[model samples]
Target: MDTTAAVPPATVIPHPSTAQGATPVRHNLVSLRRLFWLRWALLGGQAALLVSCEAVAGVILPYSPLLAIFSLQALFNLLTGLRLRQHTGRGARPGDAELMGQLMVDLTALSAILFFTGGATNPFVSFYLPGLAIAAAILPWRHVVALAFYALACYSLMLIEYVPLNLHNPDNAINYHLAGMWLNFVASATMIAVFVSRLSGVLRQRDAELNLAREQLLRDARVEALNDQAAAVAHEIGTPLATLAVIAGELRADAADPRLGATRVSAYLPDLQTMEQQLELCKSILARLRDDHETAAPQRIDAWLDGYVERWQLRHPHARLEANAIGDAAGLPVEAARVGQILTILLDNAARSQLAAGHEQIPLRLAISLDDHGTPPTLTFRVTDRGLGIPPAQRARLGEAPMASMHGGQGIGVYLAQSAAQQMGGRLAWHDHHEGGTVAELRLPAPAPEPLPAAPPPASPLTTNPR
Candidate 1:
């Protein structure tokens, strides 16, 4: 009897460098769990203190009401921990919507509890500010505004309704008591607002810096990949170029009499000339590849895509190429060389596959756009090919294995493209195009930089020869 039950299929886990949006969600969830535990511990300590106060002072301190409130808060904390554990354990990230919802609920509950337990009169009400601070630091501005409103409303209500019952005694001055309570409320709220606003600003700055560092990392990765490819390309072309050079040398050296067999000599002359020209082309290609290693400049999207598509068409003259731009190309930020390299690989693959299938023409399309809904916009570059679409099984493994042995058994180009995307703080995703082919989408965050003085116009053609 076979003892082996079929194993479940493995899930695709994106690398931290390549995973977008999800990384922050995972980070937020983990942070929330940590905060939850910290709050739980604090609440436990608060409970112990309440017990001590009730025992020694004989003052019916508000332990019962506070404990009951804390119980609900603890439940929410436990649920949050469970959700975070599930997310991290599965190697999957949480969604933004879910994260936002959790934050809102957590803040609302804490604020409500503070309002009910003596509002401004409660000594511990100030503790509630930290929760709001966390929300403002991580959430978008709109959500931050919502939290601000929640804080204002809760504090306002607490100031109006809370009144100490034993104010007529010789020791108690109701007016002074009310005045002190209002003063404390104003002070705590002011401190919380100032601290949270400042803290949120600092967080935003740090997040921007993190994004820039990630982009630089991507640029380094692309440079490394280009170096490797340049080496391989040189190796591949060297032998052919050497053979042609040798043949040209021999023909020139022979110098057989043109009078005895002019026709034969003339024919050989054309062949030699053709070989020399092809050898020159090879040498030029090698020179350009070498030069690329020296100056790895950033690229403009519109110009880069246009040039790449044109060069691809030159190699496969019969292939169809299409391009579309969705964002303003004038001021976009991207590494030109890396973007071009990625487009070239995709277009080259499509052309080769089409040629192999004996098609006279293959269609290729590229789209570039930006997503502006969030604080930092995201840039999207998509390349689609109307050729043999990748199978689901193979698509699943596109970026998993060493490019050399992925599902379709192709390597280098695809691996480099994927690597370049990640190095640039972006992701490379492959899906079936709606019109019956494969689409590769690269997504990156667009963080605006400090404005610099304009430089001289670029000398190189906006688009290079599509080789």
Candidate 2:
């Protein structure tokens, strides 16, 4: 009765703009992780190359300052790891500015090493490009441009600075440069491939999640609008329904009076009684609308289904329905009213379909079952009608929005039913029955079964006189 209850509150899903605003922070967090490991790999490679140059290439170079730069880079890397751990522990992530600062540090560290080894003449100076590439992949355009300019400044400064590789054989210098280029190519290629591809994957996944949230929010908005309309209509019709009930009561009373005469009284008595029953039913519906906010106690699945089917029969006395309950599982608690509304809509549709297909004589079948073997257990309701099965084109579009159906339905009820199903963490689907009709199935998440009471211990054996 309370349609708004099916739509999730705004607090559950933030606005689209808010989601967009948070994207940068998430992107920065992912970038920082990759940067952390990238720096570690660079440090290890620099150390290995330094050792090889000294032992194998026979190059005499300044080891003191270079080793000091490596030690400082390693220490900074340890601090970066600690920062990441601390932020993550508190359920926070590093921001874009922090990430930019990290890239700047790497650039500075590289320049310091290059300044000592051979400045711009060092073959590994091209490593600056890979760092810039990584920055571009994760950071915004403004941050990427800033990092680019900073790297350019470092390169220019290196060109004018000091420190040259001292080699005994000048002929081997070109060979070393060529070999270093090959190694740089391999390392740079690997770093870019691993980090950029993974970052792209993360970006793709985030986009997918955002899109899904946006669609869900849109659906909820539509449902909320529909609920407002329903509430208004309910309020407006209350007086008219009450008036009709009073009129029906007065008519019945007059029919019972002897002044009406026996023949006339008999003619109208049955119709008057039917009118009274229908008026009571309408009044009950309005009463439910008033108390929609109250949380009704859950009812056992079996009892609720039986009562619902009986009430449905009252609404459609002309259409015959065969209701069957199958399953041994007992005491499966169900949200009675909410589920009843969903099934009521389904049954109404089936009846309409039967009329449209000229099969009103065919008895509609309703089967209810409790399946405990499912992972979380499921309560299922199957409604089968020998009527016009859904068209292929309309199958996918059903319940998405209110559209005019071939069977003369406005489709608002189906949409509400679908939303209600989702709110209950359940599913509603329709398929062609094997017996040549449409079968609508509603699968609801059944509550966990109550534990069985422990058997009482047998009364202690009657006290023996020998004791």
Candidate 3:
């Protein structure tokens, strides 16, 4: 069957347009608030540092004019904090470009203050490099370049003004100091530029990969939903097709006057049988599909498996069935229907494979057990058959791969069986049996159930009133 044609196309809403109107107000508010808090914390830290520096300088170096500069930086931090709060309160977020521009403006003002305090000769001038690094991290390439140029211009102006002045030194030490400062600034700027650019590129690549994975996941979900719908439709038509087959057979036998020739009736009989078989196949497919989503209240694993084996034996009367509990599986609790379906699929597959191979007598063996290594236990089911072992090439594609070419003339029974096993948080894997033929094993997590309370004793019956 062409599953795509049987199922309708799924309507997908893109992530950006999932919310109609209202501008995604909640998300925008959250994003803005998060940014506001981050910026406020950073600015608050900067303010504290400036205030501490100002206090220390005022006490130790009372005559030094740099104390005023530190105070001015502290005031600027306080103002930036207030602006951030206001922006957050209004539910407004500054665009990336605007934020970068503001960072550049703040860095430039700091650089100017540092130059005025001690020019290139002051150790505090080294602090300017950190601001430049921050700018590189947050700003676009063109903006970073523009900021770098502005810093260079300001440094040059400070050097020109300080070199001629003999405020601290008699000799012209400012020239040598200016050259060293310029080299440090250039080196820091280069390093920051390289680091930030590489980091941004890595983030962009990771985002692209995540987006591709999400899209692929959505597409797979749509395809699976389509398959489920097709299975349902096939199941619904099965009974009617079976009825038609019965009627066709009766007509073939009763037509004795030769209104329809024997050859024509014979040709129609095979087609009728084929249709009936197709209907049965459809019913099986639908059952497997339903089993994929089945969940049942927890029950003892051994009892479930034993009961299932008994039911399957009735269905395949000619097959010899052998079932055994290997370990503590009898007491293990599990979702009975899902576990039963998985066992049924495995046993049915083994039986059918044996019949297809023309085995004189079909032998189906099943083993149920548990593996308890640590806190959680694992339930295991192993089904072995004395049939033609799956060919090496075909065994490789038994799980999720399409089995059209592997099955040759047969339909998709094996594929659906494998799918049902996996949907139950288990796996179906085929291997050669010890003596011969094939064995498929399924493993699932043991269900954990809370202990039930003991029941109360029943009371004696009361006398009934006269009618």
Pick by lDDT: which candidate is best?
2
Writing each residue's lDDT as its tens digit, candidate 2 over 1-467 gives 11121221112445865756566556666778788888888888888877888788777778888889889999998999998888767767787789989999998988888888788988889989888988888788999999999999989988898588888788999998888788879988998889888999999988887887788787886567446535533632443455456657877777687886355556767666666656665656556545644324566654555556666665665677876556543346666666676777777788778877889888888777778887887888888998888886776777777666776566776776787787788878989878777988989887776543322322222111110
Q: Comparing candidate 2 with candidate 3, which one achieves the higher TM-score?
A: 2
List the candidate numbers ranked by lDDT, top first. 2, 1, 3
lDDT of every model, 2 decimals:
0.58, 0.72, 0.55
Best by TM-score: 2
> Deviation in angstroms for 169 in model 2?
1.6
Candidate 2 global lDDT: 0.72
For residues 425-462, could you state the per-residue lDDT of candidate 1 as single tens digits?
77778888686667778788774632433434433322
Weakest ten-residue segment in model 2 by summed lDDT: 458-467
Which sections of candidate 2 miss by over 4 Å? 1-27, 219-229, 256-467
TM-score per prediction, in order, is 0.46, 0.52, 0.42
What's the distance in Å from true for residue 275, model 3? 17
Error of 1 at 280 (Å): 4.1
